[model samples]
Target chain A: MLSIVAALCGLMLVATKAFTAEQIASNHHSYALKTIEHLLQQEVPATFSLTDLPYGECDNYIVNQISAAGYVGEIQYLTVWRAQQDTLSMRVVRHSETPGIGDFIDHQRSPWITQFDFESAQAFTTLDGVSGATVTSNSVRRAAIGALKTKDIYCG
Target chain B: MGEPKTKQTRTFSDGVLKRNPAWIQLLGLCPLLAVSTTVVNALGLALASTFVVVGSNVCISLLRKFILQNARLAVFVLVIASFTTIATLLLEAYAFALYMKIALFVQIIVTNCMILGRAESFASRQSVGKTFLDALGTAVGFSIALIGLGGIREILSQGTLLAGAELLFGSAAKGWTITLTDGGLWPLAGFAPGAFIVAGLLFALVKSLGRASTEQPPMQLKGES
Candidate 1:
């Protein structure tokens, strides 16, 4: 009887673990996509594809279909840009941040995040800081600037 | 030794005032430190822990007859672990956000010596009613300590009574947070070091009072020697 009870409990634990893991992963993915869409807005192509770069590699490229945004003049603000006929804006994705304090940068609560939209490459090179999360805000800014600098070499 | 009623009441009072787990015994320091950062977090954690401890004690008492003398420790652990798992699942299903915030601290409740200590020391040899009262008293004592610690930390660290109200009561409390714009240096309250200092001070205060009461002379009875 004890063995049977133990087995049932073990099975229940495993089932719950699997269910929660899947739910957490799905929630994280949808949240990441929402952040991406908020940043790119209408400039993003409807059928753009996502690619995972090699681990620890600096440069990554995303192919976007641009319709409204123009090329050359608009290319500098391209945190992530593709060079096929029309220019498409691309941005590097970030994962994980301290809750409440550092995580607000991912949301529009801080207008500084919106500065990436329709920016010149020069302007994009220097993102401003969020009032509270200095370290996280600076890190995001530095990554955005690096992506803009390497856009031509990777996307062009 | 006398009527079970009198003995049970004594056990209950012992847990609440004399042998209080948090103030006197100082058991379960991990969750006490980690979740006491906010009033709501502390309250939620305290309630969850109380449920587990009480449930485990009752179950252990019921099974005391069947448990082998040498395997009592094993049985106690199994019972506590089972209750802790149930608590975790309930939290995950209903309070996902708070569950995430509390995280591993919830599981650590299984190892809280207070629960197992009660099981071994009180429940294992007591009647069901007595064990139940003991568990209730201990839980109340633990909850009081948690709430006290959380209140101090919240007021000092965030200058608010309930800083993260939504985490406990849900979206209805979205605007319920009290903001203290001028809240000063709460470096001790927000960090781990602050938790230790506060817990130590509270423990010391309780211990000193206990010592003082014990040392006081009893008044003479009218007919006594």
Candidate 2:
């Protein structure tokens, strides 16, 4: 009975996964575009161009996957950096950081991430991290600095 | 031994009030407090939880006779987990923005004690029809508790109601936001500590109301004199 139930449950999962995969992918694409537009402070042009970066870039917006050692584990996020403007935006794609305290890294959770909006790489150096979440703050800071370094390598 | 049948309405009211899983039983407080910062988020989690609870309850009740005592819990977990995954997938496809905000809590529904408790104590023993009503009532009760906290927190912390209704209710709900104040009056209400404080207050209020309803005039007996 256990095996049969498990098999049935597994089949249902497979069917649901196949059914929703395309929609989920499209949702993710639109969300990424929204984030890019938010960072650029402009609407993403239809049929925007992509670059050869690891995570691919949208026109001037270079997207990089940065994994920084957070309070618990590596915090992975897609950083949208505009080399010309020296401004970058980060959206946490995954993390196991303590919720409530360390989750302020998520833009939806708090405006702490907004401090990075439209700010130059140099300005990030002096920015204060969230109180009581020093490790998380530093981890995000490292990712921002890493994005800045990427501008030098790819844009140059 | 077979138990006496209860009226469907009584079963439902028991789940929603007298035996409310959240307020009285205090099951599933994790997601209850975590994803209730906003009305939209609370509703998102509530709907996801409702789907899982109702789906798992019906499935478990139908299969209860076939499930052995030793393997009952394992089966319940599998069913609940499957329903939770289905809910997560649907939310991702249809309500992606709201899904992102409360995805973690939605995923955690599989482990919510309320659903598992119902499966063990009610669904596994009761008839499917009864189990269905119980599950629906519990879900509604849980939703009320979640939304109550969500509404209070959103108002106190952000000074608005349904500020991001669009995330869950679509484009039509974009105009649903009602600003009550300028926001940031009590920012702590948006955090975990505030959840606990507000929940404590709400529970206290519910307890007072419950006591009031139970209060009655003294009864006279023939031999009292």
Candidate 3:
């Protein structure tokens, strides 16, 4: 009985996955384009591929994935670069930092992540991290630096 | 022994009010308290949850007779997980922003006590129609608790209602934000701690309201809490 049910459930999952994969991928593509547009502060690019980065022709706008040595674990983020190679924005897209404190790196939870926006790479150096969440802030800072310096970027 | 049939309305209201899983039974409070800080997030999670509950209940009811007793829980988990995956994929395809905000929390619905409890306690034995109504009732009850909490928190913390109305209602609703106050918002209410504070206040409010006709007055509630 368990095996039968498991087989049926697995079939249902496979069907659903096939049905939605394309639409979900397209949705993600549009979102990445929107983020790239925001960083460039210009008309949405004619085309951009996340796999092939330094996306915009101007190269002023880039979104790169970077993982820095965070306090609890490596912090993974997408750093949006713009304007004379400054960080237009930094979002902690994924992280395993402590909740209630370190997880504040997520903009949905706290605007502390906004502090990195619009800061040039050189300017980012002198910035103070979030008081209580120093490790997370520093981790995000390191991630952003790496993202900005990397030639390969992850727009997503 | 086979239990006597329950009245349809009574069964429905039991899930909605008298035995509300969130307000009274207090099951599935984590998502109720966590993802409900904003109206759109609350609505997104609630809809996804309702989808899973209704779908799993249907599947569980249909398959109840053939289940091996010992493996019943495993079957239930598989059915629930399948529906949850479907819901998550749909949300990703249609409402990407809202999905991202809630992707982690929504996946946890597979483990939500309210949905699983319904599957184990009722859907496993009940007829299809009754289970369907119960699932809807349960979803409605959960939605009420979540939206109520979300409304209060968003209003106090953001100084605006439906602040990011587009996420759920689409581009047409992007202009739907209604600024309630020029007074500054208390940012704390927008975070985790504020959910606890607001949920506590809501619990007290609901309890006090329940007491009004039987044992109390409105003025007393104001002073008591």
For B92-142, candidate 2 gives per-residue lDDT tens digits of 999998887887789889889899988998999989989999999999999
Off by over 4 Å in 2: A49-76, A80-89, A93-98, A116-156, B1-6, B182-186, B215-225
Best by TM-score: 2
lDDT of 1: 0.65
Candidate 1 per-residue lDDT over residues B1-225, each given as its tens digit: 457677778888878877778777777777888779888889888878888988889877877787778777877887788778877776766666676566457777898888988898889998787889999999988888999999888878878877767877888997887777567357578668888888888877877787788874432212101
Cα lDDT, all candidates = 0.65, 0.83, 0.77
* lDDT tens readout by residue for model 3, B135-200: 989999999999888888888888777778799779999888888986437878887798889888
Output the worst ten-in-a-row residue range by lDDT, candidate 1 chain A. Answer: A67-76
Candidate 1: list runs displaced more than 4 Å: A1-156, B1-7, B213-225
DockQ of each: 0.07, 0.60, 0.55
Candidate that scores best on DockQ: 2
TM-scores for all predictions: 0.63, 0.83, 0.79
Order of the predicted models by lDDT, top scorer first: 2, 3, 1
Worst lDDT window (10 residues) for model 3 chain B?
B216-225
- Record all residue pairs in model 2 with backbone atoms less than 3 Å apart, i.e. clashing: none
Using lDDT as the yardstick, the better of models 1 and 3 is 3
* Better lDDT candidate (1, 2): 2
RMSD of 2: 6.3
